[model samples]
Target chain A: MKISFPYMGTSHIVVSYLFEKLGFEVIYPPTPSKRTLSLGVQYAPEFACLPFKIVLGTYLEVVEKGAEILITSGGCGPCRAGYYGELHKRILHDLGYPVEMIVIEPPLVEPLDFLRKLHKIVKPKGIFNLLHYGRIALEKLKALDVVESTLHELRPLALDKQQINQAYIEGLELIRQADSVKEVIEAKKAALEMLESVPADHTFKPLRIGLIGEIYVVLEPAANHDIERLLGERGAYVHRSIFLANWTRDNVLAHGEKDIRAMAIPYLNQMVGGHGQNSVGEVVRYAEEGFDGVIQLAPFTCIPEIVAKSIMPAVSRDKNIPVMTLFLDEQTGQAGIETRIEAFLDLLWQKRKKQEAS
Target chain B: MQAYLGVDVGSVSTNLVVIDDDGNVLVDLYLRTQGQPIQAVQEGMKQVEEAIKGKKIEICGVGTTGSARTLSGVIVGADTVKNEITAHAVAASHLVPDVQTVLEIGGQDSKIIILRDGIVVDFAMNTVCAAGTGSFLDHQAARLNIPIEDFGGLALQSEASVRIAGRCSVFAESDMIHKQQMGHPTPDIIAGLCDALVRNYLNNVGKGKEILAPVVFQGGVAANVGIRAAFEKALGLKIIVPDYFKVMGAIGAALLAKATVKEKGETNFRGFVVSDLEYQASSFECQGCPNLCEIVNISVDDKVLARWGGRCGKWDTLSKTG
Candidate 1:
């Protein structure tokens, strides 16, 4: 069966590597675009949040491309995210497409159920085989994060942006086409070296902006209008708090970072909803990390983020790290986003000068 | 005399302001956009030049803001392009020194800016819904058979306040009609609308942030006296509406332009001569990928100056290169 999944930044690349190991053909849909958004808008409820629409759009695009099996993660919270699997199933069925959906939740929710379903999909011969497969998947995930972080580090500093982008594309290509873990390791090393050797201008120091918010909007470039790249091009060193590997390790394995949870306790005593606690915690973490500023991005009308956004001003006031929240929807214009980013950079520049003077 | 030029070409209005090195407004022009920003900007610029016919004012810098900022920046060779939030905050703090908060409601959108020591510490913008914007007032005024300019004065004459749902424009309009049919005074209905819009802005765009004073209220809608009074009643603080409130975005832009030129010592401004030239804009769907992003191109005298509106940076990169 040709299996497909929604494109959320580099998540598809990581998952593709896993399915390849399972000896299954994977149909990777093109990156979510305006067409995908339009499709989602047409079918999704008028008041549905932006992420729901984009996910729906991706499903339509990939399904039309002849993929019958779809795998997506499920959340358990006050947010509509938990119901997306059933919702998408009905949407696909009504649209007259025959598709099988595998919804993966955190093992904490149902450990045996998660493992049993995962075993069926991977078809592991035995325990050792499962262990080996898991190791490879985790390794690939680590390498992906390394390559992505390197790209962000080099993007604004490189004299020739094309060189940075070229190295990144080639690095991803190598990993995508690699047949063994050794080749993947070599590819990651080459990518990191290429990024480091891109010849950066030392005279200019880019502003450091921390990006934190909902997993879908923060991780997916298209949903938020490629904000990271847009900020990077304008001389911002972007630090994203959400990574697929880190998120999976924290959620499924219950090995999440303890500091964030501890930091969030003052403002957010308990888990309010989907990523609500995490959003507040990440902002505090970013502030303590000496970030120049922070940007909180979430879909418009997102209840959980709305809750987090209300409490964010208190954190910003106490931390002294300027926080700007952008609520995205289908109607959001790029010019508005650009203007805000530029102005924010302007504010950060002035603040830095003021601090230096003191 | 060395001066800076700022242009705010929004969807509803295109405002232009000329400020001296000391941030004093030398000239300001406000004109309706009428769905054609290009013509509106050219006409506004022509008027500004006419007003300064005898002055040999040298433009040291140029800046732009509003929804059409990028397009206008390209047309005017702007050195700085900023968003409305920062622009409004800067202009407010400049006019009302020690200003702690700003309430700016434009034709198509509304925003709130909270400042600390004249630097913007927090700000929020609302472009998603129209319940809290000026267009809703314009629409309601037209439906009430009263000119928009007189809509505010009518509200001031109200004997008592009436409650109208301001959560959505569609609901507000129907509620207003219902109120009118029940024989409510015209002034009372209009006053309720003013109050409704104020409540909407406070609840939506003004949520979470502390609305501190000395607060400055600006933008096209600041002209409405009733809304100004509504803000005062709701916040229980004096709202300062500057003399140049309607053109504050342009003023902030000019101030920013001055700052930008001070750092660089040179301006990219094309000058008033741009008014006499023609600019053409067009769009085509890029077939480079399945995304099919519609790339728009702007040409000045048959020389393509800019291309944008693509999700991927391919078109933007190609345009800058080629």
Candidate 2:
């Protein structure tokens, strides 16, 4: 079966490997672009958020490329993301596209729903067979995640830009070659070892930057223009706020811990009602941690980020941290970003020098 | 006594608030943005000037927030220019020592803030949608020919609630019309609309985050008892709407300005005379690249004050003569 998947942060990396392992031909949508955004904006309701537009863009592009089965992830909450899959399906149907959309909701929430989704996708012979396949898939997924995380760390350290690019290409190739769970594990180990050999100058002082923002822009390389790589090439140590492990801990396990903790200080936790609290917390933490700078990345027209943007100044003041907010849209230009980044780095270096002189 | 001035110029509103050295509000004014932020800021400053007309107020610091903060800051010679999130979180923390989640649905957008121990940890904003925003409700009210002032009161009077689809404004409109055609009473439909809006907000903007108790609902929408009741029913928890709901952003800006002044020991306010000046704004689409950014320039007496919005700093560099 030919399967198509919309990009879901870095979740695609794991799911793609799993689909390939299950003997399904996987066709991933091309990286996000202006054309993708335009197409999405045209078809989607005017009021849908930018993320929805980007996702719709991916689906439309992949479906047009003749993929039969569409795979998407699902969520549940007060956030708009949970309902995107349903709305997307309706939109595609309205647009006269005949394709089966398989939404993979959080399986832990409802076991029956999870089983139903699995049945629709795989049609395993029995429960034992399904479990067996699931184990192997899970193993592969874990391995893929490990390699991706390691690469994320190394991408900012390589001496030459080409070295980082080559390392990623090699790692992706290894992932593609794995035939089983054990093979995937071995492949990940080999990829990490290969990355370790890439030479680093160790002479230049790395500018330490903390990246804080919404999930998609933080993890999706295409969405962020491979920001970590760009900054790493300039000898900056990029500290990303979102990690798969942290996400699982926060959203899956101790999901409400932050809110619960905020309860003691009602003024701070006002629950103005969304990700605004989390954004503020991350900025404050980054500031307290003494990062040279903080970059707040969010899709254009994102409300929580707007709130967070409003709050960052005081965080900057209280902790004496400098923050730069980048609002991404279809019109975001490479040169414009590069200039701002360079200027920000200059400011950071100047501050460091002034601190030393004083 | 030392004082600080903070201006928050949002797309829908412009606000100016003055705070004393101890972070106490002395003067506050909130006005419609009316598509001209310069004029709004001038008017807001005039109100602030008049309120503290006789007090020996020394402007020791000035800060700006919101979408138009940059322009307003440049015009007012602000000591600090910041974003809305930090300012709001800071003020919210100061006001309610234990605010966990901040639910702010304003004229144009909605925001959710997750706080941990007086610091913001996570946040989400809905700047693109009208469904979960006050504008959507305003539009619906105009269509229903219901006075926006009486909307919440009428909604509270409903004995039976009618269900309206709140997925999108278009969908909600059709659903509301369908309900009305089915002989649903105005009060029931209005209350149902409020519930539908609340449902849409939870479904769209608040997805995937844990919403704990001690939620504070601020912004202009907080005044609507119907929506507040709907939120309470939906979340099964009481929400605290602060006394200064409509001017929270402005108040936050004022508090931030106060903090900055205490830390920096100076101010750069242009004062109330700015209200009498003629400010003009012009925009030109940059043709340097396909981005075609509409660079906006604001000026006083043909002398440029600030230039922003172009993706590339081409226009910014050119307008540096200001």
Candidate 3:
């Protein structure tokens, strides 16, 4: 069967590799094109979150490309992601596409439910093979995250953004081609070399800006107008709170290593659903980490993020780190975002200069 | 006489401010953008030149601000190009020395700037909303057959406070018409509109902001005393409207220009004669990849000056090379 899934930055590389290793003919959903948004918007319910429409559009696109199976993850409520799977299914069915769907919703209470769901989708392959490939996939995710974080860290300090961008592209390709964990590690080192080859501004201490928000909007560059790269070019180091590996581990595997939720105790005592609780904790963590500023990006009309945004001012006040909130949707104009980001950077720069003077 | 020039090219107004080394305003000019920022900038520049006459005004640096900052900066050859929030904050702090908050209502949107000491600590802007902006008032004024200048006085003449829906301009417009049909006095309706707008601004742009005493209200909308009064009544504190409220953005830009020039020890000011140059702005959808960014291309005569709006910076490099 031809398999397909929606795109989320570099996660596509790892996903495409994963399914292919599982002996499935995977047709990766093409990078979210302009048409993807328009088509999605036309079919989607008005006021539905952005990530939902984009994913719906990508599914229709891949379905039209002769893909018979669609695999996507599902989320619990308060965020629109919980409803996305069923609604997207109905949308495709009404659009006249007869497609089989596999939705892997990680159970909040019982982890075995997640495994059972995965096993149901791949009954022929068995649990052992799934576990084996999953381990490799996780390794690949770690390597990709490292390379991406490095690219973000260095892109701001580098003299030429293009040089770093090109290196990152090549670096991802190498990781995608690697078959073993050692090869993935070697691929990461090669990528690091490519990134470090670019000349860096040694004298300038780059401003560090923490990126905290909903996972889909934060991870997908196209969704938020490529804010990370924009921040890098504007002379700020981006320290994101979410990565593919970490997210997969935290949410799906229940990897309880870093209790990010514990950081939210003083401010947000209870989970408000989705990533609302996480966003609160992230800002607190970022403040403690000595970040110069924090930017909260959320899809327009997103419930959880809206809750977090209302409480953000208090966090900014208590932590003494300037925070800027940007809500994104299809209608978000580039110039407006540019102005806000530029203004935020200027505030950080002035704050840094003042602290140094004092 | 070494002076710095600042140009604020907003959606509705194009303002210019020329300040001497001592920060005294030597010349100020305000003109309507009227859908063409280039023409407005050129006209404003010429007016500044004429206003100075033979006063030997040597421009030491140039700064540009507002929504069309990049376009204006390219056209005017600015030493520093900054956003309106920073420009407004800087200008307000300079004018009202101990200013704690700045409430700026422009043509298309409104913003709130919270400042501690002299630096902007927090700020919020209305997103793609025109309910709490100057254009909303301007539209209602035109419909009422009154000049925009007399809007404040008319609003003040009302005996009773009428309630008009100002959550969305579409709803507000219909609600306004409904209020008029209900035989509410024109002044009362206008006053209601002002109150509604203030409520909208405070709820949206000014949400969660620490608006301390000495709040400075500026921008083109500040010309209307009714909105200022509405701001005062709502906040229960007198709002300070500076003398150069309309051109505060330009003034702030000029201050930034001086600071930038001092640090760099040079100026990129293309000179006053740039008013005579032919400029054109156009855009095309880049087809390089899946993300078809509609890149904005600015040109001087036939030569391409700058290209932007792309997700990738490659198009920006093309403009630099050309």
Candidate 2 lDDT over residue span A1-358, tens digit each: 7788877555666667667656678887776766777989899888667788888998899888887788876643555667888898888888888778887655666567767878766662445554665566556556656766666566556675566557766876776677667887788888888777788655666678888777777777656656776677666778877765456545533344364326323225554433556667776777667788888887776676776777665666667777777677654535445534654665566566766777
Best by lDDT: 3
Which candidate, 1 or 3, would have the higher lDDT against the true structure?
A: 3
How close to the true structure is residue B51 of candidate 1, measured as C-alpha lDDT? 85
Could you give candidate 3's per-residue lDDT for residues A33-152 as a string of tens digits? Answer: 779888898999988988988888899889989888888877744567877888888889888998887777766545676767676656756667767777778889999999999988
Q: Which ten residues in a row have the lowest lDDT in candidate 2 chain A?
A: A259-268
Per-model i-RMS in Å?
Answer: 2.1, 10.2, 1.2
TM-score of 3: 0.97
Q: What lDDT does candidate 1 reach at residue B151? A: 88
Write down the lDDT of every candidate, Cα atoms only.
Answer: 0.85, 0.73, 0.87
What global local distance difference test value does model 1 have? Answer: 0.85
Q: Per-residue lDDT of B1-322 in model 1, one digit per residue for the tens?
A: 9988999998789999999988999999999999998889889889988988889888789999998888899989999988877888889888899999988888888888888887877777775677868888888888888999998999999989789999999999999999999999999999998999999899888877888889899999999999999999999999899999999999999998999889998999988888998899989988887667778888877778888887656776644545
lDDT pick, better of 2 and 3: 3
What tier of docking accuracy does candidate 2 attain? incorrect
lDDT of 3 by residue, B160-237 (tens): 979999899999999989988999999999899899999999998888888898899998899998898999999999
In Å, residue B197's CA in model 1 sits off its true spot by 1.0
- The runs of at least 3 residues in candidate 1 whose Cα sits more than 4 Å from the true structure, single-residue gaps closed, are A124-130, A253-258, B317-322
